[model samples]
Target: MRKIWDIHGGIHPEENKHQSTGTAIGSIPLPPEIILPLNQHIGAPAEACVSVGDKVLKGQLVAKAQGLFSAGIHASTSGEVIAIEDRVVTHPSGMSAQCIIIKPDGEDRWTQLDACEDYAQLDHDRLVQKIRAAGIVGMGGAGFPTAIKVNPKSNKHVKTLIFNGTECEPYITADDMLMRERADDIVKGVQLIARFMGEVEETLIGIEDNKPEAIAAMQKAAEGTDIEVVVFPTKYPSGGEKQLIQILTGKEVPSGGLPADIGIVVQNVGTALAAYRAVRFGEPLISRVTTVVGETLTTQRNIDVLIGTPLSFVLEQHGFKAEKKQRLIIGGPMMGFAANDFDVPVVKTTNCILAPTQKELPLAPPAQACIRCGMCAEACPASLLPQQLFWYSQAEDHDRLKAHNLFDCIECGACSYVCPSNIPLVQYYRASKGAIKIANAEREKSDKARVRFEFRQERIAKAEAEKEAKRLARKKAAEEAKKLLAEKADSPAAANEKTTSKPGAAAAKPQAADPATQKAKLERALSSAQSRVERAQKALNDEQEEADEARLDSLRARLKQAELKASEAQAKLDEFGKAPEVTVGGEQAIKDKMAMSPRDKLEKNLASLNKRLSTAQERLAEAQANGAATVDALKMGVEKLQQKVNDAEQELAQLGPDSAAQGAAETAPALSAAEQAIEKAKAKAAAQASMSEEEKAAAKLEALKARLEKARARLTKAEEEQDENIDAFRAGVEKLEQKLTELSN
Candidate 1:
């Protein structure tokens, strides 16, 4: 016999085990349908692998485990899948989960099995995989995956493997009945787990003194083996994992820790039997022994119920008296919850379905205020301050509740049982635990959001700094180029070149007198002036329509100037004549102009327009900086010059590439500003024309990305200022984003 250690607090309620133990473990007839919930255990819910209308076999893997902590779900009987949708499941809250409903065909067919003649021949990893595939969980009610408990980390050596057969709860006798009948199978499972654990020090089966028949059967089965069947004084809640560990090995698991941490592993006796069947016979956990007991039933005993069998169906098998039943609860009364619906199906974790009469298990009286009687404190199995935790829970003070070790409370209802005030102390602790978890999750989410926001701000700031650096670098380069130009212009070689080229430059000016060339220039001037006039007139009309006096006066003045320019351009065109034929007197002049070539003429024209644009832009900037009245007129003049420059460059581009090369070589030594601008424009056009469609798309995508960044910046500024055009800026940003996405794709 092993010396047993007792826990701090416990209370023995009425032992209602005799009602279920009178009869042996029995099986119910196959129901018409079985409803299997994907999530019958803790951790992530299993994902269904079967669809409605699919034929499935008994022990078929209908759902696969989602992760390591979860367990797979198997069909209980050979059937056709009828439905796969949300249905009421066996839960404390009576919640609905994804279920696979099957209609039995009465055949009880099974898929091929890979049974092992001897589990000892398999390796540790193979054994664990086999157990995991079996879908076995802690049938003792915690529903923790059995594979995870048996297989600890390599460094954490397990010394003891204890089987829990205490069944200390009020009316649960599923394990008790299983032990009395299937003792040898349970011992075999214990040996298999011990082998999986490498070299466990001792194997012990912990039972309470109240279960004498179970103790004797387990001892007889454990004979000639190192496994020990240890019995101790019966106490309420001793079946708890931690409590059982303490009672069997005198070792207490650390708070918020597991038995594996203390070199020990505990598994429910039912789980052992399930594992044994799974490994030895290649059977999945399709059914479990469940105690059906209560005064509201005509018959009360343990039933080998198929997983997913509806509670209503099971109750009908035993002649349940609905009118006499006060409440329907799953598990034992100490830790069970009232089931709201009879349609809820039983799961692997359901040990007992308790339906009691009003007189047999009457509802608790209405809760009264706490009286500080100290009885609850004495009866707390976890040695926690129930009164303090209850107070903090009522106040919704999560920090204080955590400080009082509220999570350590096993919610055994011992404190509530001893309370004179009838306060549901355990309910308060459960609610507080839920509240604290939610609060912690929300706080963690907030922290992540804060981190992301800070990271975005830093990225934006870095981009801005880089942009500023590039601008300064470009400014410096331009200043250096200007300084070099000035120095070259003052050099003797430049002076000699300029002096020598003056006559040719002067000679080239006379070509402007040619009738054909002069007429074309005047026509172009007229077209540009008319375009400016239209733009200014439109601006004035828009202002007038809006009745905005501030911009109307400036717009009118700009329109008047544009009209004057247009009139002068028309007069020049009329004076020059529109006829295509030139007079004999100007025939020599046309010949001289023709010698310069059309490409040279267009290039020179582009150079002149570029100079004029540069001057106009400078004047506009100065006027705007000084807040001058001519700011609007200067801006209009700059726009017109830019348009003329673009037109000249386009005409130059129309000339053949050979002509462009010839022109570039002729003006290579001392390139003018307009010549340089023409060269750049021509090169750009040639590059674009040479590019493939994909290359062009890539370039456009890059430009769109840049535009989107600038637009987003503007939108941010507008939003910060609460500007009236904030919506317009936001729309612009979205448009740019859409374009970018399309181009990227």
Candidate 2:
């Protein structure tokens, strides 16, 4: 006999478990359809791997775990995925959730499985993955992913691995019958879990003394090993993870903490068997032994029910009667919720299909005012004052509810079971807990919003300060320029001094030319200025299309500068009015200079063609080197430019130009560099969209390297006090480096 520690509060409910334990475990026939909910466990829903109308073999993965806390889901039998849509699921909220519906083929075929006799030789990570792949969860009640549960935090080492075989809930014998039939498998799973935990010191199996057969079976199976089967007295709600831990180890798990926090890990016996099948036989959790017991059913026994089987079908198999006002509970009466609709399918957390008649388990009388009785408090397993919590919960006094440790209540219904007023105490606590959780989440969101707003304000303030500093600096520069101009204007000697102080100013001065030559140069410069102004006006006045404002402005500015130079030249020539004959000859000279020979025109055109060809060739090479999609277009552009260059050279030769002048011939239309860059970008995007995974990864790696270099430059600048937000800049550098390392690995 093992010493069983007494918990704070408990009740001795009628043990109706024997009704379902008299016979051997039965097998369930395949239902017409199964509805597998994506979120059968306690975390994020698993992602569906199969689509509608796909044929899937039994035990094939239908959905994969979404994240670290989710479990995989496999098909219960060979079937076609008829639909993937929202359906009724086993949740207390009575809401429809995403589920996969399958139509069985009656073949009972299985997918290829990989069994391992040498699982112990596998590394720890491999074992965890195997368990996760098998979809093992805490079958006792919580339905937490077992793989994550078995893995304690890095700082904590598992010492005691307790198997909860104490099926203390009323009218639930699923675990008991499972132990009696498959004790060896359960024991093997226990050993596997210990091995996974790096050799847990104590492997204890806790079973109620009322389950003599189960205890004996486990003890026999665990023989010749270090596993211990601890038998204690039968007590209602004794199978809770925390309660069992205290009973077996005389240690209490701190409030709102896990047994793992105290170096103890608990796994339900059914979960252990599932782990055994997964590790040894490579069978996933496609089926479970569910206890179907109630007066509404003709048969009351445990059956190996396939997961996702409809509750109505299972009840019909047991000769269920359809009544207008019948109760169908999904678990033990104490902690189970009423299922008004029978369309919901069985899920991983379902332990019992209890359909007790109103007579077998009658409804409680309506509640009366509390007489300030301490009876509810005395029955609270967590030692909480239920009366206080209930009043505060109704009043919506969340602070008082939390102060009274309302979250620690497991809602086992022990208080309601013994309540004289028949108050639904558990319901109040559940609602209060939900309210508190919502309030806390809203508070967290508000805090995050506040931080973002403050950060944005700070950024705005910094930007305004920088803008003001730049404005002040520009004003100071203008003031200094104005001061120099005023000093020169105040004195003629100061202006002369400034000019003489300039480097090479005296050396750059030129002697005056003869009057004939000077007059000719001035007239030629004036003609050139007039030609520029006419060209600028023609470009601006073109009506075939909209003129570019920036281009027109640039031309106008150039024409103004040319006119200013021509005016200065004319002024210098006016000083030599003694040359009247030169003025008449200068007009003829202007016409001769403006009209170029055909060979000269051809040479100039060829030079432009060569420049375009060279630019196109450079672009093509760059595109090819970067593996850009613009390669083909750039290559075509280069070929076209090259052909133009060749044609220009031939034309120059035809014009009777010398061989040395054949390089220039005809002008070619060319795309601006900005337009070329835009095309390159579009082509690159198209190429990236068509790339394979590996190619995409390579491109991403290159991009990350470039970004990393930029980040490093920014970090260096920040270090040199060139910018603020040094911490953010440093973090960006580190983040880029981390991404690079991951990609490299």
Candidate 3:
């Protein structure tokens, strides 16, 4: 014997279910067209598979499940897909959603189905997959996918499975009639679910004692099975998922938790029958038994209506009187919503369509302010403080609303129905819930952005630290090398001193006076002078200060210093070093080394002149393109570079042809990088002079396009960095783009 548990609060409204339950379940004929919504379930919307003008059969898949939580949609009857577009759907919002419309061919044909007579022999996963493929969902108005509800977490075990035949809503007799007429199929569905569950200790069916016929029918079907039909006292909302679980198992599901969390799984009687037909007979959920009852219906009864059939068609077939109907409600009167658009099609969750007159279901009076009433709290089944929630929600105090457990409200309309002050408490709670969800989503996005910003800052700091460490190491190495060089210059060192107490006469030569040492000193001096010249030129070109005569003077002085250092080194070699004039071959070597110095100086000057000329040409081109005022300054720079180049050539020519033969032997082995660059530039100039006009134009166009692309890339980077020179880069890009466009045309 199972003990029935009591809930916190409930109301006993008039159960006008007899008007629909009196007759046997009837079948409605097919309408001219059916409109099926893709988002019939609670998760992601299903994806449509059929296009307009495609032929389809009854039970054929028209829309496939989009995700794990969604269910598939199938054709209710054989037809041609006439439209796939947004249309009115069965929702409280009365909005249009994606739908597939079909025009029936009257054949009522079905596609091939894979049925399993002995489902118990199949694997559990296979059975679940079969149910999912059949497009079965919770028909109990929740519309949650049934495959998801049945399969609990691996760690959680279901001890009892409850079939809710209570049908406690007022004026809704679909489930009750189903239990009375199809009890054997319902029982078979129960056994099938139990087998899928694997370890259920008890399988129970709960129905209100008001429907004796339903209880007797279910009991007779479960004579030899493990199913038990338990009849309890009739209550208004005893059919709620949580309330039914509490009534049968004597366990209160924790707030914001499901019944499966408490080792229980509940399914509506209609859902179970659908599952049975899906697995045993291979019929997809294309139709359901809907109760058509109210004052406006000439015939009040249950009819097996096809899914996606328009409500207008069903009501019209039942002798619906439009003039007498005051409200068109879907579902029971207590929890149903009023329908404003009659073309809205019935979905998987729809069970009842009530066309009641104004007297049968009167409109609620205008809501007045709360008068400190406790009736709402007394009527709440979830034990929530309704008045406080209403106050906080109206005040927009979200934190207080959360603290009062606003989400725990089932929105069953029990509170508003029992409110003496007539305050619409449920409406206020719904608004608050929407606000809370939006707030949570925005907060989550902000947190993710903050995390990304912090990560980027950390990376930059790490890179800067690594660069600083490398800089310090290089400074230390340079200082150590300088110290070692100074030590060698200050004191004479002998290699034999470490082996003997006294140094040999040959080892008495000072390390600083060695020929190699002198050569190294001269090389270092030249390299330092060349580096200074490069730095001065770079500063002048980068800053674009053509009037900086002081900078030009400084560059000239540095070049003179380099020349003086070369001369002093040559004089030193002539005085202290062995004379190359001693041998017959030595005379030629002496002349070669002497000529090498002047050649190197001229080569360095020529390279600098070439670089200045290139810089001047670039500035001149920009000034011409932008109509700037700096053309004269740039043209003067270009003329000075040309003159310097001419002078260098003259000097090279003045040195006789013998000088080249004389210096080639010695300078070839010791040519500096600058001297090598001068040779390459000379070769390229000779080649350019030999090219045809057409070839030159093509090459020039290619170069301009390359430059434009590079400039555009720099401009983009500068914009992102908010650089101060962004305008400069943008101007350069535009100029290059214009030049390329002209050349292309």
Candidate 4:
């Protein structure tokens, strides 16, 4: 049944496993200086918690975890930090990442790590916390956070736990040695994780049929336990999570579904050892056993190395002649990236560093055009139409590539191996995948900006509607007031009554007589002007705050320097033979080695600092000169603000006691001014209507939509072509899929 269940499509190239598997893993002596990368794991690189000159103890976390996905970085040896800057990292891209360089102080001091024999007694969350705090991460090639993966999501109801011991990739033996040496520890760790996974109905440790010794050792360890040891056929990528699960349980982890979705969880054997060390010894995953081997090396053996230790160091230790090796790789030939720079540090996921000579791993020559051979389609493990993907990618048809499931290509290099043209198919696929990801990110950013734009547009429309409603209400109120006044005067009864009642008074003597009412109008005007002045003052305060924050960075740097100087003086007096300065001023002398020359006092001061960093060391005389100039600038700015405040106060004081009445009288004129201002604002808004950013975007979108319609029509016409060629293509596809399936099986 399992034989029948093996999914089709793969290539079986020469298995070059003997180059590095002969010897067991042994620890390497630590180098005088170790450069530890903060971002050794898969997630967000850990943030640097310590500075360039801080003294760190072994096992102490030098860099704290940046996020839930990030892992903490521990010091491999008690050392003074030499530098924290860009260095060669273990990335396949060979780019520089942040690294913490530590110079061992010869003490080999430890931070007193916590160990527990009764680790199982601890609460599950506490165990996960301990794992995280200890900086434990997956030692498998994946380098995912181990604590994150240990849990079998309850929603998925994981029923089977598969311990993946299938080190099927040729020329790597890190996991195989670990299993052979510490089967019991791995078994224990497996049980610990199994408990975390809740009820595990079945636990299977799947090792390849080739390693009978490893299988025997694990089987012995699982004697009384429910853990089952299963042997699988020797096949390339049989160790892949999906392929392994299928081999053992005949369960497929549907196209996008994880192991948990199929009630199964798979973990690497190397990860099992890491789990044991972390849980039993309370040790973080600082070092991992890496297979450094190939025919070009002076010696081939697995070395246990600290994460972020440079590959050059490992090669030098093994007597490898770097110049002689034609090719260097970070993992198996099937899946690893080429290493042009040997200085790349060992990352958490780095399992093997293969230094192969031309004879061992020969480079293929330039490729010619495909002869419609269909061999690549036959070799694809994902059962994808590699030929179709190649066509889309070649034509730069991103949409077509996506339709062909370009993302599903895991970049195993099987297609490249089988192609007669010797094309670097995987490189093309990788470039396409990278392009697609970047496009996706750009689309997401554009979507966010569009959402913000839409919100702004909606708010503007709402505010305009409200403003129009307010204007109509004011117009209606004014009309009503005028109507009431007209009715009172026009009524015959009102006129007759008023005339009859005015017998005592002269006909021309009708007038208003209240001085206080006039005074009230002037005060209201003064208050409005005062409010405007206050608004101006608040704006000035905001600008001042911005100025202060901008100065904060330089101020903080000075503060750090001062603190280091004070600590240095104390350290010198406390000890007879004082420690050598780790920093000179605040700069790390990574590029310079100290010797022969008479060290200046500033250099001595810089050496003793803990995280004391400096941009550039300027002479004291220059600093004094700069200080004097800065003082003058500050004086001028103060004088300017004071003058402005004084002018504002004087303007307010000029308005006398009759200011209130004067302001009241000016209210009618103020209303007229406000009406004029509103008219100007409305005219400006009308003028901007066609020139607004929203208007421009709308036009662009319309143009794009038209182009899209045209493209869609062309695509439809192209698709109709399939009917003519499809029968032959389908037959070609079936034959190709069959060949690939045959090779895979």
Worst 10 residues of 3 by lDDT: 572-581
What tens digits encode model 4's per-residue C-alpha lDDT throughout 1-745?
A: 1242465576566776666667777777777678888778778999888988899988888888988888898988888999998987776677888899988888878888788899879888877877788777766677778777775455878889988998878888888877878899899889888887787899888888888778888989999998888886687777777877878888777675677887888888777777778888888777888888887788887888877677888888888886778888999888898888877777778899888889888889999998889888877767888888888888889999988878777787888888899988888888888888899999999999999779767866875676576557656655765576688668997689777775667575343322333233333333333333333333344344444765554454343333333333322333322324333442334222221121232234334331122211222234456773223223323343454445444444454344554555444333334565797799877866857787755665565555555445444544574333345555554555554455435
Model 1 — TM-score against the truth?
0.69
* Model 1 stretches astray by more than 4 angstroms: 465-480, 499-745
Give per-residue CA lDDT, model 2, range 300-341, as digits (tens).
999999999999999999988766225899899999999978
What is the lDDT, from 0 to 100, of the residue 319 in candidate 2? 86
TM-score of 3: 0.67
* TM-score for each predicted model, relative to the true structure: 0.69, 0.69, 0.67, 0.67
Task: Give lDDT for model 2.
Answer: 0.83
Off by over 4 Å in 4: 1-5, 465-510, 513-745
The regions of model 3 sitting more than 4 angstroms off are 50-54, 459-745
Candidate 1 has which clashing residue pairs, if any?
607-674
Highest-lDDT candidate: 1
Count of residue pairs whose backbone atoms collide, per candidate = 1, 2, 0, 15
Task: Give lDDT tens digits, candidate 1, residues 1-745.
Answer: 4688989889989988899999889989998789999998989999999988999999999999998889999999999999999998887666788999999999999988879996788998999999999999999888999999888998899999888999899999999999999999999998998898988889899999999999999999999999988989989889888888988878888888888899998899999999999999899999999999998899999999999999999999999999898999998888999999998988999999999999998889999988888998888878889999989999998888888888888889999989998898888888888888888999999999999779767866875676576557656655765676688669998699667775534453332244544565676677778767867775675457655776787887677688668756764675456335555677776545545645767877787678667766776788789996455556556756786887688777777676665766655554555776898899999999999998998898888887898789878877885654688999898888887777667
Superposed by TM-score, candidate 1 places the C-alpha of residue 649 at a distance from the truth, in angstroms, of 23
